[model samples]
Target: MGVFLETSRLVLRPFGAGDVDLLVALDGDPAVMRFINGGRPTSREAVEARVLPRLLRDYPWGTRGYWAAEEKGGGGFLGWFEFRPVEAENPAVVELGYRLNRSAWGRGYATEGSRALIHKGFTDLGVERVTANTMAVNTGSRRVMEKSGLTLVRHFTGDWPERIEGSEHGEVEYALTRSRWERTRQPPAAPRP
Candidate 1:
């Protein structure tokens, strides 16, 4: 119905109004925001007054505020992931993204959640494509994108304030079209016959 998608180990649920604290904590981690903000922390007020509201306001649309990536085993929050239709003229295209705490890193949580979202985008949401973009230097994120079956689509530059070391190299976009996704999906093997 609303913003809830489930994977084997996660429940991607909507970010309630109360999740401001979570945002504060998440953005406070420098290593977590390293590639984006150059390891600076976003103020809690900024998260509450701006970011959280923007995410929460999008609930009615095909996209939700933010999906709280909760572990089904412990029912604990790992972070958040978002899969949403790009609001441009090309509305059928969705963007895939996640922001997780450092503690959640190296656990394949990003890959697992991304695969589920991609499958749903094609099979259930009638999405024509899924796209993700990040700094070219963010190899960790690039790996997740690649593992989700997206390929490098382009390299481009964007304006940034902090200007990390590799900003000059530009950013990369990885994308998967519906046809590509369908073609790449392998049929179930005959139970290892």
Candidate 2:
């Protein structure tokens, strides 16, 4: 499969037909799925029927929204990242998301990949804004968003079908705009004499 993006230690590639097992393994971890589904495992049937199809679908902007993340040197499947447009015909605003195996947590992969995607969106993908959301108590994910140059935009209650552990506190949205991002980008260093 063609690589969508690459960082120093990760390779983001398009999902393939043979990646069902990887998805199954990733969603099968209770610790990883805690905030998503109250520690429930996603059935393989659901992965094949719904999850994989959504990942495989191409957006109207001519790109895949989800990418399978892997370690640089054959370290194997870690999980996935999402950088999809909010509107089907407009690439101006996009949402960012990530889900990694328990083994990959605390390794900075989330922040690294998010930063790269934000940079790409702003520079090459005609994106004007990037946004992300997580359960209010998800401090780890919040930190990743902050590290990726996003700021808290709002806190609102989502109408989830089932209440997760932290649902009582609602959810938080973080965002970064192109103008803000450009202002924060480091200027080129002066040439030496």
Against the reference, the lDDT scores of all candidates come to: 0.80, 0.90
Query: Which residue pairs overlap in candidate 1's backbone?
Result: 55-65
List candidate 1 segments past 4 Å from native. 1-3, 59-65, 88-90, 186-193
Q: Best TM-score goes to which candidate?
A: 2
Which residue runs of candidate 2 sit more than 4 Å off their true CA positions?
186-193
Tell me the deviation in Å of residue 2 in model 1: 6.5
Model 1 whole-model lDDT (C-alpha atoms): 0.80
Model 2, range 85-186, lDDT digits (tens) per residue?
Answer: 898778899999999999988888898889888888888899999999999999999998998889999999999899889999999999999999999962
Given candidate 2, what's the lDDT at residue 132? 99
The lowest-lDDT stretch of 10 consecutive residues in candidate 1 is 184-193
Task: Measure candidate 1: CA RMSD.
Answer: 3.7
Residues 39-158 of candidate 1: C-alpha lDDT, one tens digit per residue: 889898899889887676553245563588888766777888878777643447888999989988988889888888888778877788899999999999999899888999999998
* Strongest candidate by lDDT: 2
